[model samples]
Target: MKWSEISIHTTNEAIEPISNILHEAGASGVVIEDPFELSKERVDRFGEIYQLNPDDYPDEGVIIKAYIPINSFLGETVEEIKDAINNLILFNIDIGKNSVTISEVNEEEWATAWKKYYNPVKISERFTIVPTWEDYTPVSSDELIIELDPGMAFGTGTHPTTVMCVQALERTVKKGDECIDVGTGTGVLSIAAAMLGSSKVTALDLDEVAVHSAILNIKLNKVNDVVSVAQNNLLDGISEQVDIVVANILAEVILRFTDDVAKVVKPGGYFIASGIIGQKKQQVKEAIEQVDFTIQETLVMEDWVAFIARKN
Candidate 1:
């Protein structure tokens, strides 16, 4: 239940890669907290919100957190955890002039502290994702409801990139179309596709954690029969050509697998590509075009771009 908090200040650009490295190290998870998440108290007042837009939020910094189990620190006296934290700090300083702050959390309260941050998030017009602990009753017109408790996986549809993908899904997926959600983080899009009447769905991700999370979410929405979950990459090791291919991943990876994405979709199939910054959209578009696909539409959210293309 005990946790250690280590905050690292780095560029929003560098946080993900560094956080991935930290995850590979020993950190269970790293929350790339926007400084806006930080709150300050006002004199003689209830909590007054600070209007800190992520755009205005300093792009040159990030807060990296790693939790250490209290039992391990107390009973076994694990110096390795401390060493790993120090190593992360050293690594960041060597790579860049970033700073880190480290602290410990009370064991008993650490487990539930994150709950305060994970609340009900309404994703789209027809769908709303609520945490398991939060009470929510969908209106009569609510077409779909996905419940989650983000257990050891990502994708609550809050991240800008993920939200863009979901929006793209809303636009492209139609009744009875087959959908393949590549990098199916937390199964949000796949379930959305199913609820949107994707006749058949296949969800794939290289991460086993994502695959497991996808399966659980798909079942939670009772869409297991419509959506099949698998662990794969860019349609590899799969033979079906879907009507829609949704891959929300880094631009580098998407361009690398552009041909594969095109091949995995049938002629006239929809290809929804997301997770690319505005500057990288041209490269992705060229890659898609090189593979005989044409961009039908583009959606921009913040600095990120999502392309809905068609294999012609």
Candidate 2:
């Protein structure tokens, strides 16, 4: 099928609202290209970032792209999306240039375009996330390779939040430890836990798609024997006391369930909370503290934050 590609040249501040508008208008797989990302220095505790080409980014502002299936109402849908973005100004948002353009492309191209940007990435001292289609050889005997399709429902597990969570798990999980991964997404952390020598790992996600993807990736990594995948809400009705509970979800969501996490984590067990943007760092920290968790370490990467808190 052919798809219409819509590109918006907008401000960094406008990306979220504009992306929402596009998604509501039936867009799929929104991509953001900000020149700032080209120059942005990542906190490389996990891995080194190769320099991105500046030619791919606009000089003055960010560009947002999304694909919408070509249809009779394509014009109207695009117009509605533009109007919604322009409406953001009423809410005091700077829409920036707000220029929108459309081009047609094949479904195959749309599906494969983003895959080029994803390859084998060693995100931590022990963990390297590799796309299933790529050929990667480990640099050391102890290097742990995790394979996943970039098309996985939640993410490829190479995001900074997941990277930090895996790194934290490496630090906290001990031989024969029992671990729970709340909001497991593609089951990366649970797989990491199992590979890191956890005796048992429970991977949970509320999204059915995520559960299936995690199950697939878990088995692909050959850790299915040690890890179990389940469709579950954030630690709801969980009773098992485990040595570690790792959650790489939003700070807001983490704050909502820190108590539930606290309940299931054994005394002196660790909770790895990540997927927090810098703005919500303090609130998440305080929430963890309120749950009787003593913060042992706070890992920051770019605008994201993760905490390794031990249950008291």
Find the candidate with the highest TM-score and give its number.
Answer: 2
TM-score of 1: 0.73
Which 10-residue window of candidate 2 scores lowest in summed lDDT?
Answer: 41-50
**Once superposed on the true structure, which residue ranges of model 2 sit more than 4 Å away at CA?**
8-24, 43-47, 58-62, 78-100
lDDT (tens digit, per residue) of candidate 1 on 141-242: 744778875666776666668777777888888799998888988988888889888999988899999889888878887999999988886677776788
| Model 2 residue 97 lDDT score | 90
Clashing pairs in 1: 1-107, 2-107, 10-62
- TM-score of candidate 2 versus the correct structure, residues matched by position: 0.86
Q: Please list the C-alpha lDDT of all candidates, in the order they appear.
A: 0.74, 0.88
Candidate 1 residue spans exceeding 4 A from truth:
6-111
TM-score of each: 0.73, 0.86
Predicted structure 1: lDDT: 0.74
The residue pairs in collision within model 2 are: none
lDDT of 2 by residue, 22-75 (tens): 888887568899898877766556455656878899998899999999999998
